[model samples]
Target: MAKTLKSWLQILLKLVNSTIGIVGISMIIYSMWMARVWQRHMEGSSDDFFSFSVIWFILTFLGIGITLCAISSFGHIAAHTANTHCLSCYMVAIFLLLLVETTLMADIILNSDWEEDFPEDPTGRFDDFKDFVKSNFNTCQWIGLFMFLAQGCSIVSATFLRTLEKRQARYCESDEDDIAPSLPFLYHPVEPLPCTVADLPGAPSSLYWC
Candidate 1:
C-alpha cells in the first residue's frame, strides 16, 4: 500500500512540475512580446524614454533565464535527481524580476508628464494611454504577481517533496535491516535434494517417501 501511495504521489509531483514548466515557458514568451512592444514604443520616442524600459529589458532577460532553468530542472527531476538549490535560486531570481516589472508598471501608471512639448498629444494620447495603462495595470500586472507567487509556492513544495523522498529511502533501508534477523540465510546457498525416489533405497516402498 505504501508503494502504491508513493507511486501516485510521484505522478502528482510530475504533473505539478509539468504544469509549472509550461507556465514558465508561457511567461518567457509573453515577456519577449512585451519587450518587442516596448522596443517599438521607445523607437517612436526620442526624449520620453525612462528607466522603466531598462527595467523591462532586465526582466525580459530574467524571464528567459528562468524558463530555461525550469526546463532543465524538470529534466533533472524526471531523471530522479533534481537540484533543489538551483530551483530555489531560479525562483528567487524570478521573484526579483517580477518585483521590478511591477514597480515599473506602477511608475508608468502614476506619473503623468503633461507638457506642451510632450511628443504625443496629452489629452488624446494621455486618455488612450491611460486606458492602456489601466488595462495592463489591472490585468497583466496581476498575472505577473500571481506567477511570482506560484513560483514561490512551487519552490517550497519541491523542497518538501525532495526531503520526503530522502527520508523514505532512509526508512526503507532501516526497515530492511530490522527484518534481517527473521530472514536469516535469505541470501545463502542451499544443497539440492535427491531427484528420484529410487535414489532413496532405504525408504519405505509402500509409503513412497521421496
Candidate 2:
C-alpha cells in the first residue's frame, strides 16, 4: 500500500494534521501560562476593571487553539473513515479556515492601522505572535506553504482514490457474478476411454479387439 500514491498521501496528511494539533496544544499551554501570570497581576491589583479584558484575552487564545485542534482531528477522522460525506465536510472546514486566514493576511497587508481594528490584549500574546512572525517571516511562510499544499493535495487525492476504489469494488463484484455460473461446467467429471487391443495383447489379436 505504501508503494501507491494514495498511501503516501494519507501518510502526509496524518503527519501534517499531527503537527497542527501539536501547535494547537502548544498554544493552549501558552494560554495557560498567560492565565497563571495574570492571576498574580489580578491578585496584586484591587481594580475589577481589568477582569473582563483578562477573561476575553484568555478565551480568545483558547478558542483559536481549540479551532485548530478540531480541524486537525476532523482531518484524521475523514482519513480513517474514508467516507465521501466526511471528506466533503473536512474540505469545507478547511475552506472556512483558509478564508479566515486569508482575511487575516489581507488585513495585515492592506490595512495601515490593523491594530486599531481589535481590542487591547491584556496578555500581549497577539503582539508576541506578531513579533515572532516578523522575526521569522521566511520560516512561517515556508511552514504555511507546506501546510496548505499538504492539506489541499492530500484531501483531493484521497477523495479521488476513494471513488476509484468504490468503482473497482463494484466492477469486481460483477465479474465474480458473471464467472459463478460456469463453475460446475468447468469442474464436471470426464468419462474413461474405451479399452484398446494393447490391453488384451496376451488373449486376442489387434483385429479381434478392433
What 10-residue stretch in candidate 1 is worst by lDDT? 114-123
Per-residue lDDT for 69-182 in model 1, tens only?
565365336424434455455446545655675776666557664233234332133444457757787786676566566555555555655556667778999999898886
Q: Rate the local accuracy (lDDT) of all candidates.
A: 0.55, 0.74
Separately for all candidates shown, the number of backbone clashes (residues 3 or more apart, or on different chains) is 0, 0
Pairs that collide in candidate 1 are none
Error of 1 at 97 (Å): 7.3
- List candidate 2 stretches off by more than 4 Å: 1-6, 46-52, 169-210
- Write the residue-wise lDDT of candidate 2 on 6-60 in tens digits: 5665666677667767767887888788777777767857666347664676777
TM-scores of the models, in the order given: 0.45, 0.69
